[model samples]
Target: MGFMDRLFAREERASVEDPRVPISSPNIIAFLGLDALSASGETVTIDSALGVPAIWAAVNFLPGTLAGLPLHLYKRTSAGRERVTGGLATILHDAVNPGMSSFDWRMYMFGQVFTEGRGVSFIERNAGGKPLNIWPLDPCGVTVKRFEGRKLYEYKDGSSRKVTYEASEVIDIPFMLKRDMLGHRSPILTNKDVIGLAQAVTKYGSKFFQNGGVPPFAIEGPFQSAGALQRSAEDLAAAVQKAAKENRLALSLPAGHTIKQLGADPEKSQLVELQRFIIEQIARIYSLPPTFLQDLTHGTFSNTEQQDLHFVKHTMRRWIQQFEQEVNLKLFGRVNNRQYVEMNVDGLLRGDFKARMEGYAKGIQNAILKPNEARRRENLPDDPEGDKLLIQGATAPLGSQPARGIGDNGGPPLNDNEGNDDAA
Candidate 1:
């Protein structure tokens, strides 16, 4: 639920931290050291376009959504209940540094998938072979190779020493992929053209603004001397800069010289629209709504909410499922087993308050929720008989048979109804 608050918030952003990748060349190939980069080539690594505001919003929104949700490790009990309070909770929620919370760890891992298309973590085990700490591995620094049918993961250790791990020891979460067993595809590389366009637009805007929104001016000259014309031009330029900065209305120009304003204004040339179009393109590249990137031009009250939900269901849900499945596989060592990890995704799917209350009322009416249970969920006080599960003129303990309005209070057989009714 706390995560839901973070997700719907408009100002929240995530900044992923990673070491600088080696410059790409013939010898050094991919960003994450995978052949998949050869499939489409990673022009925009995590370092490239990440500085752009649109990319920042898109990348951070994902990991922030993931980190906000609650992750629970549960042991399946025989009575069809999951026990969440276990030793595994420490590793799931508190295994990061002493100051860093569980959200920090989860955000880091989730952010990796966006940048590298794979999130790799090392499971450090104790003497008893139980998980001790889950350490994140830099995808760029990591290289995956196969040896005689076995997979070997190579990454620098904490001490910067080269180390190798078996496939079992590493938790590898691959993004969209085809047949490259040791490779993973990334959005930045696969959609480089779109991202590159966005980056170019950003650079163009920056250069446009850096020169005070004016292009280089041309000086008309047919002077008596070349050096004199140059000196006059330099003097005019200095006078113009000083006047502009000092807020002077007029500049004192030399007599035989005239001024003509140079290039067209950015507004006239639709530069703002161009930048906005690039923002929309970047949003599309990340499969995020333009509104998510602060582009509310096309947003409406009705469609905005639906688009946000679509962002969660279509975009965020993909990464969330990836995180969950990989976590389950690495933590439990089995996909279909009694012990596993589950993410609380209901928070994101929940509707507004009126709708939620109406749904809760329906649940209580159908005996799916007792009055006390609903009250507890809504943080309300429990009533005297709130625990009673009421049905059609009858009441019973949850998961138990209705008493048929019998006087099962261990008193005399009086004041009881034959039909489903409450009695005194």
Candidate 2:
């Protein structure tokens, strides 16, 4: 073959061998909350919560054991005005420079449990016994405020007029997480446990909100007024439970004592395969493709040509890194050269090339099948007899009904017979 032919041959081989077909996998999610406040009698309070499931999965699952480590939850609060070291009036000059108060220091000394892939849900009772939505605030827009014992004076024009108002106002802050695994049913976070934890956390967090500090110029209202946090917690708990049950059902086998047992037997291999097949069928029915799966075995084997698939390698690496940071999960598998390359190329073909081809096919199909309404209006002739024959030959069966149009009933407005009669 000529050089050009040889090059084309290589390209064709690579296209046929593409490995990244039918991407299928789950995504990571996250949630976070923080509060700070100061109130009467020099009281100050700060609270925070962070969810890092992705991180947990990477460290705990990938390496085969959960790492014994502490995740930090930081908080800060301001002390009240008092006598200053310099020769300055206590009221005029702030005594404390907003350093961490002793109370805040003590609170942080005993670090809080920042568990991975865990959530708490609870019912919040408003003073008036009305339902509230608290979910939105936990993972979205939230604020805190503090009220000091002292009062502030608002002066009107002249005559040393003074209006006493308590010091308090609200401050809003936003936090973003790398991932949120709220609804997943991982062994690490069971459905009942997650629900219980969510409930407990919401109960405790509410207490902090209610009894914490009040901000200047702000009147203390019901703590659970913003029902978003509580609602989210409940929803998350429910979802976790549902997912756990489903996951258990999916992994269960008729004769096996455990999921691992089912997976271990060679005889039950077909059953397991059938399960995956059903999952794929469901995905197809929903018009969703499988998530990407990486067989890490390929890279470990001694193969030069396999390693040359730089694009696939880079993509997998990036995915792994994201999984680590967001889910705390690490993937460990030896890359099989043949399977890796095949899957990678297949993924590329199915994703990029297949999409492009489908688009082109759709354009052609529309051009051929769609009646040229504008041409018909202008009284233009249809294609030549030979072209008509070719077009007819190219047309596929009208297996389904066409979409509705202006003043058209829910049926094909015109068929071949009708068109023929009109032409005649």
Candidate 3:
């Protein structure tokens, strides 16, 4: 007999009235998604929420308490049970299974056993006319089968059938309640502890360095790249000095103060000096050679002074373009053919400057050797033959020995003045 029947039997033995007798379990209660197949080959689906309150009422109350209870009492008292069953049905509906109808039997039986005090021992019976007793004596020991597929339910009388449940459905009815449900609480780390953890990470990272090298900032200036030291005051001064020498700017005075003192007058006394300083600064900053600057602005200036000023302005454009183009190449990683053409133009100007300088040096040599009015007018030198003779003497090869000294004489003395002179 089921637990409800046993309670009813006990109530009868006590001779008390049955309060729930007038109202059948089906009329006062309903089960969501509940289905059953009877021996008559008829299937019933219980769709109402209150259709099966008897299962819960029977479990929660004593037998005589509900035996004569009114239908209204079942309706009002069944709210909590209805809520739980509705939630269970919703879980079943969302579960991974063919349909809730397939698992309706298991859900219904489980809900009944859960609400009613009947354990799995009474629910699961073996074929040998004995109870399976799957429910443990200790509440914590009870095992729950998470129904994933069709599980077979068998009776002690050897009746068996396949019962399927939705795999996604979960019934979390605990056998017992306790203070610590699972285990002790875990400890949490504080902010100070986290900082210590970060420090540990940095310490370990330090050990991984194979060379045991000092930090980069600890190295001296000369050890670093030229680019790294470019912004230093010493480097800037050196660059200015080198640029001044290459451009032939007179460095007898400091270039910086000279440019500032010259102001804007192109015809002023110090203007030419200022222009030279500016030109040198431009060439150094842009890394362009000075010859390239001079040839681009020919000799259009009215005087040597104006020529220096003109050269500074003319060269500034070329140097700026070249420096800007190089910067662009680094920034964008490319330069077009047009930019190369511009650079070639500057290079041609530089070549022309070199040729002019060579011709000027030759003229100076001619003037030095023959300083006479008539030779200057003819662009000729008075001692041209002397110069030719000097060139010929420089190219001539020495004989094996020199003419002998006045008396002693083999073929010649090897130590004659012609060979022995230190200058020779």
Candidate topping TM-score: 1
TM per prediction:
0.76, 0.15, 0.13
* TM-score ranking, high to low: 1, 2, 3
Tens-digit lDDT string for candidate 1 (342-373):
77777787778998899888888888888887
- Kindly report which residue stretches of model 1 are placed more than 4 angstroms away from their true locations once superposed: 1-45, 96-100, 158-160, 249-252, 260-264, 371-389, 392-424
Clashes of 1: 0
Shift of residue 12 alpha carbon in model 3, Å:
95
Q: Against the correct fold, how does model 2 do in TM-score?
A: 0.15
lDDT of 2 by residue, 199-287 (tens): 34344444433422111122222335558445644553444456554553232222312211111232333533443443343223212
| Window of ten residues with lowest summed lDDT in model 3 | 182-191
Give the lDDT of residue 392 in candidate 2. 32
Query: Model 3, stretches more than 4 Å misplaced?
Result: 1-315, 318-342, 345-414, 417-424
What does each candidate score in C-alpha RMSD?
11.6, 34.1, 47.9
Give the local distance difference test score of model 2: 0.26
Alpha carbon lDDT at 110, candidate 3: 32
Q: Tens digit of lDDT per residue, candidate 3, span 113-144?
A: 23321212122234742222212121112222
